[model samples]
Target: MLTPLFERRIDRMNRGIAEGSLTARLPSGETRVLGGRAAGPAAVIELRSWRAMLRLALDGSSGWYAAWLAGEWASPDPVQLFALFTGNRAALAVEARAMGPSLLAKRVWHWLRRNHRSGSRRNIRFHYDLGNDFYEAWLDSRMNYSSAIFRGAESLEDAQAAKLRAMLERTATAPGDKILEIGCGWGPFVELAAREGRSVHGITLSTEQKAYAETRLSGHAGARFSLTDYRDVTGTYDAVASIEMAEAVGRRYWPDYLAAIARALKPGGHAALQFITYDDAMFEAYAANVDFIQRHVFPGGLLISESAFRALAAENGLLWQDQVNFGASYAETLRQWRERFDAAADADRLPAQFDAKFVDLWRYYLMYCEGGFRGGSIDVVQITLVKD
Candidate 1:
């Protein structure tokens, strides 16, 4: 009952395919030719197996293809499956190279200003901002919306709760303290903090999320949501925190993002930001994974090198207080999300394509990220900072 909107959108996406710029790998480990219809909008590409097509459609790789095929996975987009098989991975690679660290930072900054506004942010809203009801089916009750922490939990709900509690504890916040949550998702932190008698102010880019948070916090006088970019926030707070939203801020804006937080915090105020980052020194092993995320998942996102973070923090007058690594926790969290998504799909609350695509993408995303962490290719770092 989704009407023709999803189908129409799929059609439009296929039309972009007809323009013949798209390319994807086949199960045979070779790229295939996609033929446009002589008179229609759809293009056809043949694969040897439905499993192959599904992998191409879902995971784009055969390694974990069966995981999604057996009805065991989920993610935000189904088209990523199509993207893997029929979209242009080579082009994505080229673009990823264009964003390499060796490239001048100023040049990267200029490119970000030009392309940052409409890339991943639009894609995120197109897929994620549909409604909280859609996400509620799969996510934990807290609706944290960022990656869950999977430490010492036997179940998904328990793990996500741990993640939330960890956030609250790490900040070491007190009741009635003023806190700023950058890129607040659904206001879980605001709700949690407010419940603890803290005055919480949250800023986010998603209007749908802001609206949902407002409703979620309707009775909490200590919590407030604002539809403002981080750069525009001007005030003093006891603490500052951001969860998983720094990727979209882009490396070009990292300094600015840190600067804004530093400015917004009172002198000696503590800040904690948790994010997924690539170990650029290990580029060969993990760079491809990062490229995939940029192309199909978070288009304009950037993963900062730890050294880059240190230098940026120092430059912005932020004293590095402490840093914690939670990569294994994130991997466990993704696994839980995939399971929940599959369950939701089985119950018929989630669309088939959505479930399949997410499973495939998430398997790759999670495993790759997990491998990065284990192999030191990437890290999920919670860096505590203080204004000097």
Candidate 2:
């Protein structure tokens, strides 16, 4: 059903794949192979209709997702397909990115949801307020929502505990030290710190998170949870820990985020941050258009540019140090989460309000993130920034 113009477009996209192999079954009952020039992950995609190609040509990742939802395409292993596209993003040019009206519309929508103070609360609630029960259905015990460090860990719970301990170690806080946790999701780290007799204050915008954290740590007098913004934080702390939270702070607020960290820390205090970042080469294109994650999963979210972030930290009197990259571990974590989610759905453990479409969307989201991490274009890292 593809016209000559669409056929040429597909050929152009296939030619750009310099590193991997993609076996595409076109809607016209023809098969085409692209990108066998070098060794990489092999992915196969079956186009059920020409509309799939139209969607890709028009809307990029978001459009491709819509095509899948509408049954225009199918892939046995979508993770590899996503990995292929993400890995060769540079070579693929604009083939996998939003363009024209779709690009402009998505960009405008994302800008409206930008991480301004008011919009931050709305954005945070949009994702995290899906209810604690929904998360508890799939998330490991202790409810850590970020990446888990997998070194020497046997299970997802253990890996999450290891990640928490590692981040706590980076804070370098002794007993009785005052610790501030920005964007404390479900109070895992705060409870850990409080159990060690450190005074811990956790701030978040999600009402569910605050309620859950407060009830979870009710017995710990040293642990506190509040609905607070990072920009409005008061008092200096001995150390700070913010895990996977800075991504919510858009590029426009990077300086403000760093400044808040700098101002909240006492002299010589360390602030541990675990954040996701786009490779320097990919940041320009990524920032130029709204991505699937930004458009659907986490509105107002923008991955950091490590170089730019580090420079901003330095400018704000925070010396970045002891960086660790664990993107592969994150990819593994997402795989596990997806499995758990599927199991929960099969067992009817997910909330009733979340229908089949919602479940499918979340599954796709998990795979998309995992593939991005595996593709090496995106990465998750833990770093300690010391206030000088």
Instruction: Please report the candidate that would top TM-score against the real structure.
Output: 2
lDDT per residue as tens, model 1, 1-388: 4324433433444444432322333334455444343322122332333343223333323323343445433323333333332232222222223333433342353354322445435645754576777678778887866666665747776776666677777666799799999989888878888899989999887778889889878999899999777888988999998988777777667888888988998988888788877655543433333344554455566677777778898998889866788776775676566667667767887644465566456546644444334433456877788888
TM for candidate 2 is 0.98
What's the alpha carbon RMSD for model 2?
1.2
Please give the lDDT score for candidate 1: 0.62
TM-score of each: 0.68, 0.98
- lDDT tens digits, residues 290-313, model 2? 888888899999999999999999
List the lowest-lDDT window of 10 residues for candidate 1. Answer: 87-96
Number of the top lDDT candidate: 2
